[model samples]
Target: MSTIIHASAAPKFPLPFSHAVRAGDLVYVAGQVGVDPQTLEPIGGIKEQTEQCIRNIEVILQEAGLTLDHIVKVTTHLARVEDQPEYNEVYAQMIKQPYPARITVFSGLGPYLIEMEVLAYAPSIRGE
Candidate 1:
């Protein structure tokens, strides 16, 4: 069976989408931007946006009773390829050893400098 997970800390955009959805042991996080959940505005520049995006992902993971350590893969989309190094600096600090498989994609999907999505896997929880 599949379950949908929503993060209370995520901004309510009145959009028809869940923050992340879980199926069995896997969780797929939607694309995350730099917007602050409360304000719904882009956080900062490329670096700050990258940081915020990661932080947002972490929050969603926590809501699912998971952690960054449980993430199996990450897909990043950038507005400009030139910002990769800056994005990497912040990305490296978020995950630890045996890092998750990741791919950096260049696209114009969001208004911020960085956008990210994640996939996580873990044992079933009590209410999951």
Candidate 2:
């Protein structure tokens, strides 16, 4: 059976959706914007927003009893294609070696520069 998950420390979503949903061994995290958890406002520029996006995903993963290492796939949307270089720099630093499969594309994100979503593989890590 699938289970819904929510991260109390993650930013409250403006849209209606759970932070994540776990189906058996996989957890699918909803897309996360580069917004502060407390303020729910978009952070700085591309690099900074990228960092925050990963951080936000981290929180949701943590709630699932998983870590970044558990991520198997990622999908990101960038408001500007030119911001990719800076975004990659931050991503390379935050995400470790043997990185997850990822796809990033330039898309209109309204006021935010970056948004990300992830899928993680965790086999009964929480004894669930």
Candidate 3:
């Protein structure tokens, strides 16, 4: 009745976790950081890190047979409050109109500027 989708292009941070898990019609993505998939190093500042984080989310969505448009909400984590403006600019670039509900909190990641976790929803063909 349900399945789990693992993102192949996801960054391997020496941890045991799937990118997203699909149960019923909802897909839950784990907290994603701005690290290169191959290099495994943290990306640039807030702006650049935000871009990379979104990209990683996109990859996970694709693997789960979804897209950014399917996401219902997003939770962002930042190391610095001053990065809010820059993070907004980068975030808006990837997501389109009728944006998903969002919440951004401040957390200090190891040697990182920002981290993000997204909650995405998929349509239920069975219910409707």
Q: Whose TM-score is greatest here?
A: 2
lDDT score for residue 46 of model 3: 80
Residue 112, candidate 1: C-alpha displacement in angstroms: 1.4
Instruction: Write down the lDDT that model 1 would get.
Output: 0.85
lDDT of each: 0.85, 0.91, 0.83
Q: Tell me the tens digit of each residue's lDDT in model 1 across 69-94.
A: 88888898999989999888888887
Instruction: State candidate 3's TM-score.
Output: 0.91
lDDT of 2 by residue, 1-128 (tens): 99999899999867889999999999999999999899989998998899999999999999989998888889999999899999999999999878889999889889999999999999632222
TM-score of each: 0.91, 0.94, 0.91
Q: What is the C-alpha RMSD of each candidate to the true structure, in Å?
A: 3.9, 3.3, 3.1
Clash counts for the predictions, in order:
0, 0, 0
Best by lDDT: 2
What are the per-residue Cα lDDT tens digits for candidate 3 across 97-118? 6778899888877788888887
lDDT of 2: 0.91
